[model samples]
Target: MKKPLPAAIAGAVLAYCALATPTALAQPEAASAMEEMIITAIREDRKSRGATGLDLSVYETPQSLSIINAQTMQDFGLTNINTLLKMATGVNVDPTETDRTTYSARGFDITSMHIDGVGMPFGNLIVGDIDTVIYENVEIIRGSNGLITGLGNPSGTINYVRKRPTNALASSIKLTGGSWDNQRAEVDVSVPLTESGSWAARAVLAYQDADGWLDHYSNNRQVAYVVVDGQLTDTVTLAAGYTHQDNNSDGVLWGAVPALYNDGTAIDYNVSTSTAMDWTYWDTQSDELFAELGWQISDHWLLTTSARQIDYQDNSEIFYVYANTGVGLDAATGLGLLGYPGKYADERDSLVLDASLSGRFNAWGQQHQLQFGVSSARSESEGLSYAAQSGFDVMPPFPGWNGREVPRPAFAAPIVSAEQDIDLDRIYGSLLLALTDNLNLILGASAVDYTNDGVSYGVPTSASEDGTNPYIGFTWEVLDGLNAYGSYSDIYQPQYVLGEDLNPLGSAEGKSYELGLKKAFANNTLLTLALFRTEQSNLEEFKAYGDGDGIDDTDYSDDFDYSLYRGIDVESEGVEIELAGQITGELRLQAGYTHLSLEDENGDEARTFIPRNTLKLLMTWQPQALPKLAMGLSTRWQDDIYFDSAYGRIQQDNYVVVGGYASYAITEGLSVSLNVDNAFDEEYFSSVKYEQVYYAAPRSVNVSASWAF
Candidate 1:
């Protein structure tokens, strides 16, 4: 199975062309040959569910759009969410803990995640690691999108388009082996339930077992998804599906390696080092059930309703190593290595319902679009903590440490420490008016009510908030292929984040403005340049790990469950430019560059750890000399970043990580690829939140075989 994969998932899913059958059970177009594979892989007409709720095209969205389609995923083997987001132009994926990650765009954390334009139950807080096998494409809309979401942030929104059942018979299988004993297998199949192809079902399953670059770290992940679609009537369609993802990690690092010495001197260690204990484990699972109905009121009108229920749970037994003062470790004698352990179980049940009516009409000699919707989401969470008796809590050796020599602590006496309920309700609508043949006016607004009630680890976590977010945009087609646009958007978010004092940090409000130019070409090719600014208050800033700030009282407990954050006010301004689709018949590319500046109300630099300049480049080309060969290159570069730590400043120099892939088509239906990440073996810190920081992975290689039909 040594071949080009998608020229064949592309050269099969394009196998069922015509996304036209809006009915879930509509027939899929039979895919053709690979002559236009590069162009087709770069763009999709149906990827129009972003920016506004009106399903506008990229040229009309008035915002930055980044898309990673299924063809790209199969080409690069981007089977995980974090890997996919890293390729997004303005987004950053921060892995603070071994098993937990936070995504950021512009200068703030990205809290919004949607499925098929419908908001997720709890923002971006899924319990398990996100697996991409179940998604058709991952779309990102940079800047505020309050018009499409009930809760909004300055960061962008990530919309995941779930893969549906195809009206035709299709299937694919993949096997991969990589560096560090990494192994993975995946299978995707679609079957027609009815002979006429009026009904269909699709299922995807995946499993991966891999060892990390860090010592003693390993991961085992599994995913299963199934969806069914049927035609109830000539104009009515029904679709339902379920998804399950499980992730279990062993020896997962909690915090990171301390960056400094207690004496205020910088300390550096090997990139492969880890403080995670050998016996520790973090296991999480997420299960969801969803249903959707669509009624075609007329050729120009459609009404849609969707509902979903989600259940998520996480259980972990983990350990943390830190200094007694919670600041830095001793340079000599390797002293003051304190060990902290905990046993935790958390569960969340969420219900979300959404309904909308969208259509087009002719008015004033022009065609206009309108969409209105109502949505409600409620989530209930429960958490239990078990007392951990750690005999190795104080004074352990640090030099030559890996955590394998450490003993696991005993846990007992579980107590219900956290119980909370969160709810959000909103009414939203948008209208796109064709004011003139060359100009358009877009208006939208959402009124949201957010409430939270519960107790978390002895802290009173409760709040009530209601706000209106309004959006306005203007677009003018300056030329036949160029459009100039400007937009204004606002954000209102209710927060449950805790501070160093252990109380809820409260709510946050923000506004964003953008002006940009878009150039569109044939085959959905797009180029965009944008200037944006934002002002926000009550944004949470990371303040080290643990409960107390060392100086706040001399007693630093070994409770690693509670991290610290504080509210702050900040202003952010940035410029971004991006390009997508084919540059030549043989080459297609997705590239972006961003320059950002963040400052506090007092004019002091804020969130200094965020890079001021970043650039992402991804491109693929099929050489004419070798018709069966495809090659691609990916690289991400950033400016220097620094963090003000307790003892001193932690900094990382500008660095670039490079990845490349080569695939050869063995046959039209099967392929093999060799992908090398960090091809140059560049080493840098992935994060610098505390005295401890994480090191980026070194060079790794994987060889994958795929079969598509």
Candidate 2:
């Protein structure tokens, strides 16, 4: 009676009946005529999409998914989306300026960003419309999805998927350049409207520019997208979309400016030194609209309805100058010379609502699958600031020009006015139980309601707030490949504005756990190993104020309970080793690894600045290779990090990055490509500061051409 789970997937399909003969015989019997050889291996394994013995079965899906198709972002030339989200594996991407990019997983620190699956919470100007040449894949789900969505952010979740309209009539065009003077151009098109194609449409466009390496900085970008799909009467199916993104930058680059010399000695400079300071500036914008309706209530119940709308905006201004001679005149005569200034202004807005329902069931007899959802979000933010302290010739030798100020906006008081408004509502429900077919069981739960309304003008009056959160997880398939999962999520934040004006900052919480193992081999390879733990609670600290007359306001520190993190993750999760289906035929290969163990546990060692070891590898080769020409190679690595967690110091050191691409086809329509990135420039330090340090991105090259009519 307890053994019913599709008869344990029919007794593990008769005890792996000899590896199920490669999905029940992947077509053999060609008679002695022999000549059927088509190989194009592109299986950098992320769950090799296209299935095969289910990669050795036992996929309890408690979330740990990955898919980065689109021909591996056009064979590793990867355009944006923060360089293809660093190819998954606990994703990282903390650019912090030059259009600010932030996302950290497994150890938390991710602020929701979803497209084609809803949810895009402002900032960085919507990443220039997220083109990536129309995206046909890019799905990643790490852990803790609170039962299907409802106030998310468990350090995992990203789904891009767009790129519809197939049935022939494809198009593509791309061009790129790298290193300090980067440049880019992209365009993609897909068509099929009737002609028995069931209607379809797709479009993408992009433009980019860069001349940055700090020191006055520079960057400009633009993106656009359009999608359309239709079936209408055929059990109803319709999708529509629109998106536009823009970004402009000129400031924000605080890297390198401290080799000691504040009595601590050691200050002679020249490590390939660089500087040319300048007044700062940055601007951003974003827009999006979407709609989808898919109903196929029969064949196992399936219904989906989605709607979305978004708009975001940003503006920033910065300035830095302190060269009154040697170590900036010993910190401006110890600050009595008064010659440093700061200014900033920001605004944000958001609104979202989503609904979903999914199915596949058997109920009482076991074998089941279910997904239910509901979501809502509203946000608003505003901030304004100013700081001054003139004299000493207003310190402006060569920093984006602009000097002359002897009006201490209230005696160099700095920061003024801060505002916040937020309203959230989430409700989720999940179910996935096979309880036998080799043991599959996943349960979900979620309920969240949060609110915050704040203000600060001359200080005080940080009013209104609310909270609620709940979560749970499970997934078991303990053998035949092996799998074990766990989850416990929680979050509640309220600290008002970003920087300055403190004391009204409290309410922060988190808890997480994980364990795993997966293996498959027989030519088509894959391996996985994982262990994780996390803890965080109410940590809001900042204090500064004195009769010493330097004026910087805001202070608080006494609410710290936990802040611990631990990690270990490795994957190569095997299969066909490479070239996916070899242009519809088959062969593949891939690899990955990461290990980060950090600790703070209230002892306050000043929080170890992220990164504790990471490595990734990929390889693909399409057989039947010579005639049409196609090739690919990708490799990434990172280790040695600590960019100031309060005084921990040391930024992006130990590194390795290799990229490859090649394509050729002079007929049919037209095509040509060649790409290489970070071939080996390695100088490290993406960011770090006790005062400054930022550098990353040295080797790169690109060439592309395409056409189809």
Best candidate, lDDT-wise? Answer: 1
lDDT of 1 by residue, 62-128 (tens): 8888989888988877889988888899987777667777888898888888887777525444444
Residue 99's lDDT within candidate 2 is 51
| TM-score per candidate | 0.92, 0.29
lDDT by residue (1-709, candidate 2, tens digit) is 0111121221121100111112221224342211111000000111211111012222444345556778777777666688887756666776643455556665555555565555543221232224466667776666544444443444556666666655557777767675667788888887867665555687888888876654456778888888766555434456666777777776454223443333433334332333323445566676666666555454444455565555566655443333323333242233211233345565555556555555566876885766566667666666666543432234322222222232322324445356666666666656667767666555556566656665555344344545444554455656665556554655544433323323354444565555665554455354556565555554333232222223422211111111112221211111111111222343444555666555555444333445656666656666574767777777778766654322223444667888777778788678787877767766565544223444566666777776666
Badly placed stretches (over 4 Å) of model 2 are 1-95, 104-154, 161-192, 195-199, 206-216, 222-298, 301-329, 333-359, 365-367, 370-431, 434-533, 536-599, 605-690, 693-709
Q: Distance from true position, residue 523, model 1, in Å?
A: 3.0
What is the overall TM-score of model 2 with all chains considered together? 0.29
Going through the candidates in the order shown, the clash numbers are: 14, 32
